[model samples]
Target chain A: MNIDSIQNGVVIDHIKAGKSMEIYNLLQLYNLDCPVALITNAHSGKMGAKDIIKIDSENLDIDLDVIGLIDPNATVNIIRHGQLVEKKALTLPLELRDVLKCKNPRCITSVEQDLSHVFRLTDKQSGTYRCLYCEAKAERRN
Target chain B: MRSLIDILELSTQEIDELIATANDIIEHPEAYREKCRYKKLATLFFEPSTRTRLSFEAAMYELGGQVLGFSEAQSSSAAKGESVADTVRTVSCYADIIAMRHPKEGAPLVASMAASVPVINAGDGGHNHPTQTLTDLLTITREKGRLNNLSVGFCGDLKFGRTVHSLITALSRYEGIKIVLISPDELKLPSYVKKDVLKKKGITYVQTRDLEAVMPELDILYMTRVQKERFFNEEDYLRLKDMYILTPDKLHNAKSDLSIMHPLPRVNEIHTSIDADPRACYFRQALCGKYIRMALILKLLEIE
Candidate 1:
C-alpha cells in the first residue's frame, strides 16, 4: 500500500497492533479537518505488526498523555519544515482529569453535574487507575 | 484551607499528635473548654445520622464553639437541587469550619474544594469517615496503650463496611500490626483491599470465616454489623449473621485486654448481655469520638 507522507505534521509510530483506531478516536483525530492517515498491521522489525497514524497538520495540538496512557511504547515524531524536529516518548501520567469517567454509581461525580471525574494511577505494572472518590477501579474502554 | 477527607491524608506523626491532643483533652477537659469560644462549626448532615451529628455538636459545645446547620437533606438546600460546592461555599461564610455528611461518595471532597474554610467528612456514603477512624485510633491507643505490635481482628461486613476499610488503611501505617479478617465467605474482605492495602504495604494479615477460632490471638476486636441487604437470600443472611454476634461465649478464649470496638447504632450483632463486659468499648468509643473530634476541630481552627 502506498500512502503520501505529510510535509508538516506528527507521525504516531509503534502503536500496538490494531490499537490505532482506539487511539485515533480517543485523541479525537476523526473530527480534525486536516488529512490523517491510519496505517494498521504494517510490518516492522521491532514490532511484528504495528499500527501507525500520520497527522498531516503542523498546528494540531495532541494530548501526549492520552497516548501515553493508551500505549506507553508508542513514539511521537514531530514534523516541522518537512523534517523530524523532535521524537517524544510517553509514560503513564500520575493523575488523569476528565479522561475516563468513574463507573461507580455511588461516586459523587455521577450526581454532581459540574464535577470532574478524576482518577489516579494506583498500579503502574497492572495499568490500574482507581476513581478518586469511590475507589472503583477504572475499566479500560478496550 | 486544609481538609480531612481521607485518613491517609494524615500521616503517622500527625495521627500521633492528634492522639496526644485527644488524650490531653480527655485528661484536662476544662483546658479545651474555652479553646474555640469565638469559632463556629457547621454540621451539614445531608444524610440523617443522629449519632455522628450529636457527636460533632457535643464536640463543638465542649470546645465552647457554637454549632449550626441541618441534620438531614430535606432540611437543607440540597433538597432544592443545590450543589455540594455551592452549599459548602455558603456554609463557609457562616461557620469557621464545616463537618459534612452526604449520601453520595466524595461529596465532602467536593465541599472541601469549594469551601473557604476547612471541611471535615463526618461520613460520605460508603466511602470515607476520617473522624471515625481518628476516634477508632484514639480508642485503640487509650485501650491498648500503643498502636503497634498487636494483632487486631476485624469481624463482620468486611466487603462493604467503610469503617473496616478505613480502619484497616489507618492500622496498616503502624508497625508490627497484624490484621485478622473475620467474616462469612459471602461477605469476605474484598480482594482489592487485601491486594492494594495489605500486600502493597507488606503488612501481615489472615482471613477466615470463624471468629472464635482466632479470638484468643486478638489484642483488639473491631466489629461492624453485617446488614442483611448485603446478602441476596434470606437463608444466607440468617445463617451468616448470627456467626458474628459478640456474646459472652465468643469472648471465652479472647484476651482479657481485647478492646471490643464497634461504630455505633449497632443492632443484634452485639448482644446487650455483653454490655457489662469490661472489654465492651463501643459505647466508650462513642465518647472518644467527641474528644478526638474536638482535637480535630482545634487543629483545623489553629486554636490552643
Candidate 2:
C-alpha cells in the first residue's frame, strides 16, 4: 500500500468512490477542527474502485452503522502513533435512531416536527429497515 | 380510550363501543357539541388528502373544538427537516388530540409513541386506514341495520386500496360474511389480504372482472377508483378504466336494498346519473365519515 501513514487518526476505507460525500454530509464532518484527509477513486482489487477518509484527532463519535448503510463495503481503522491500533468492521444497526427519513409521503414523521424519524432493522442481510412508527421499509440502494 | 394507532390493538368490545358512540353522535348532534369546548385538534396532514382532512376538521368543529395544522407536507416544518417524533411532541403540548395523515406506512404509529395527547391515524400511505374502515362499518350498519350475514362486494383497485384491506379485516371478525371481489386481473386483491384476512378467517369469497354480474347479488358495493397510474401500460388503463363503471343500466338487476358506497373523490367509476338513485350512498358515506370521526374524537377525549 502506497498510502501515507497518519500519526494518530481514524481511517475509513473501501467506501464507494462517489459516495464518500454522502457519508461526509451525513456525519457533518466538515465543521470539525480535526485534520481530515479524503481520498477518492482509489484502486481496489475486490471493489474495482474505492475511497478513503482519514481523520487525525481525538477519538470521535461517529455512527458506523449509517456509514455501512451508505456504503457496506467500507471498513474502519483506528490509528495510533503512526501504527494501526484497532480495526473494526462496520455493520448496520438493529434499530436506526435519528438518521434517515422515512420516504412514505403519509408518514406522520414527515409532518410532525418533534418526532425522531427512527427505523428498526428488519433484515440486515437484505439491508431492510422498517420505520419504527409507520413500518415503512427503508431499502438500501445499490 | 386514547390514540388508535393500530387495529390489532383494538378489541371487539372497544370497536363496538366506538360504533355505538358514533351512532349516538349521529342521532343527537346537539348533545355532543361543546363536549370538548376549550380543546383543539391538530390535523397534521403530511400527504394530500382533501377528503380525510376535511372530514377530521369537520368532526372537530362539530364537537365545538378548534382545528389547527397543515393540509400538505410543503406547508409544514417537516420540509425544514424537523423529525416526526419532535413534531408530535410539540403538537401534543398545543392540541388535545392529533389527527395525522402521512405517506409513510407507519407514520401515525411513530407519532403515537411520541405524542402525549391522543394521536389518530387519519391515513398512512398504502398501509391501514382505520378511520375509513370505521366509516364503512357505520355505513353498513346504518344502511342494512346489521354487520353480518351480508354479501359485500369490493370493486376496483383492490390491490392498492388500503380501505378495502381494512374493511375486509374488520368484517372478517363478524359472522357469516361473504365477499365478492370485482376487479381486472391486473388489479386483483393482494395475496396477503386474501391469505391473511379472507382465507384465514374462513370467509367465502368469489373473484371476477364483471362488476354488474356481482352487483345484483351484493348487499353493499364498495367502489374505488381504478387509477390510471396503477396500470403500467396506457392501453391496460384504457381497457380497464371503463370495465367496472356502475351505470344505471347495470343497476337494473341490482337488489332493491343494495347500498352503493364509495370511498370517494371518484373519477369515472360511478356515473353521475346514478347519484339520484336511493342506493347512491357515497355522499351519505361522507357525512357518515364526519359523524364517525366526531364520535371518535368524543370517545378519545372522554367527552361523552
Candidate 3:
C-alpha cells in the first residue's frame, strides 16, 4: 500500500471506511469552508481495510469524546513542516454535555428545551453512559 | 433529598421517622406550607403514569413548591437520543428535587447515583414502586389505626402487580400482619416474595381462588387488575376476570369495617357501584397518596 502525503493538513487515519462521512457529520465538518479530502476503501496492512480524511488549510476544533464515541479506532495526526508534529489517541469523556439525547421518554431533558442533555460515562469497559436525570443507559448505535 | 431511590436505602428508623413526619404533616399542613417555598420538583416520566406523576407534583405543590418536567418520552430529548445521566445532572441544576418513572429496571438507582439532589423513583419497569408502598403504609395505618394485627387480602394479578409485591414486602416487618393471597392458579404471587418475605417473617397466610368465601375474614382487600394481556388464551381471561370483580353485591359478605383498596386506573376488576359504598377506600387511597407524598417531600427536604 502506498502512503499518501499531504503538504499541510491533519490526517484522520484508521477510520473504518464509509464511516468517515458519519464522522464528518458528527464533527459538523460540512459547514466548514476548508477543503476536506475524504478517502474511502483504502488498504491497510494492519487493519485489513481503512479510510482516511485529510483536511487541508484548517485545524479542526474536534471533540475527542465525540470521535471516540463514533469510532474508537480513529487516530489524529497533525502535520507541520511536512512531518508528523503531533499524534493523539481519542478517549471517551468522563461526562458528555449536549451531544447526544437520552432515549428515555420521561427524562427531564427530553421536555426542557433550555436544559442540555447530559450523560456521565459509568462503565467505559461496556461503553455504558447514563442519563443524569432519568438514569437511562445511552447505548451506542452501530 | 428529592428522589426516593430505594426503600432499602432507608433504614427502619428512617422509615419510621418519615412516617412520623408524614403524620405531623397530616396533622398540621399550615406549619409546613413554607417548607419548600421556592423549590421546584421535576417529574421526568419516561413512561405513561398519570397517577404517580400527579401525586408527586401535588405533593411538592402542597409544600409550597413548583413542578416541571415531561410526562412522556416523545415530548422530551430522549426521542433525540439523550441519555439518563445527562438529563439528571442537568435537571438537578434547575429543580430542587426530581421524581422519575422509567421502563427499565434500576433506572432510578442509576439516576440517584448521578444526581446531586434527591431523586425519587416513582416506579421502574416491573422492579419497584416505593412511593406506592409508602402510600399503602400510610393508608393502612390511618384506616386500621395501626399497622400490625391486620389480615390483608391481596386479590387479582399478584405475579406482576408491583404494588402487591412492594406492599407485602413492607408489611412483612410489622408484627402479627397476616397476608391472604387471592388469585387464580395462573396469577399466583411469585415464589420469591412468598419465600423471602412471608415465610422468612413467619407471617401466617393462605392462598385461595374463592374470593367470596374469604371476604368476611380480611380487614383490608388490596385489589389489582387481572390483566387480559397476562393471559395466553382469551378464554382463560374471560373465565378468571369475572371471578375477581368486586361489586356491591359481593360486599354483603365482607366485614363492615373491611376497606377495599386498589392502586387506581382500575379496569373492571372493581365495579363502579362499589365507589359509593363507605367501604370503598380506593378513592381516598388516591388522596392518601398525595398526602403521603407531601409527607415524603417534607421529610426528604427536612425544612425544620
What DockQ values do the models have?
0.76, 0.37, 0.03
> What are the candidates' interface root-mean-square deviations?
0.9, 3.5, 7.0
- Model 3, B9-47: lDDT tens per residue? 666676677777788888898887878999999999988
Q: Comparing 1 and 2 by lDDT, which wins?
A: 1
**Comparing 2 and 3 by lDDT, which wins?**
2
Residue-level lDDT tens digits of model 2 in B180-250: 99988888998867976899899999999888777778999999987664345799778777767779998
Specify the poorest-scoring 10-residue window by lDDT in model 1 chain B: B225-234
TM-score of 3: 0.66
> Which is superior by TM-score, 2 or 3?
2
List, residue by residue over B53-98, the lDDT tens digit for candidate 1. 9999999999999999999999998889999999988988899999
Second chain alone, TM-score for each candidate:
0.96, 0.95, 0.93
Ranking by DockQ: 1, 2, 3
1 or 2: which has the higher TM-score?
Answer: 1
Q: Which segments of model 3 are wrong by more than 4 Å? A: A1-142, B1-3, B227-243
Q: Quantify all predictions' global Cα lDDT against the true fold.
A: 0.89, 0.85, 0.82
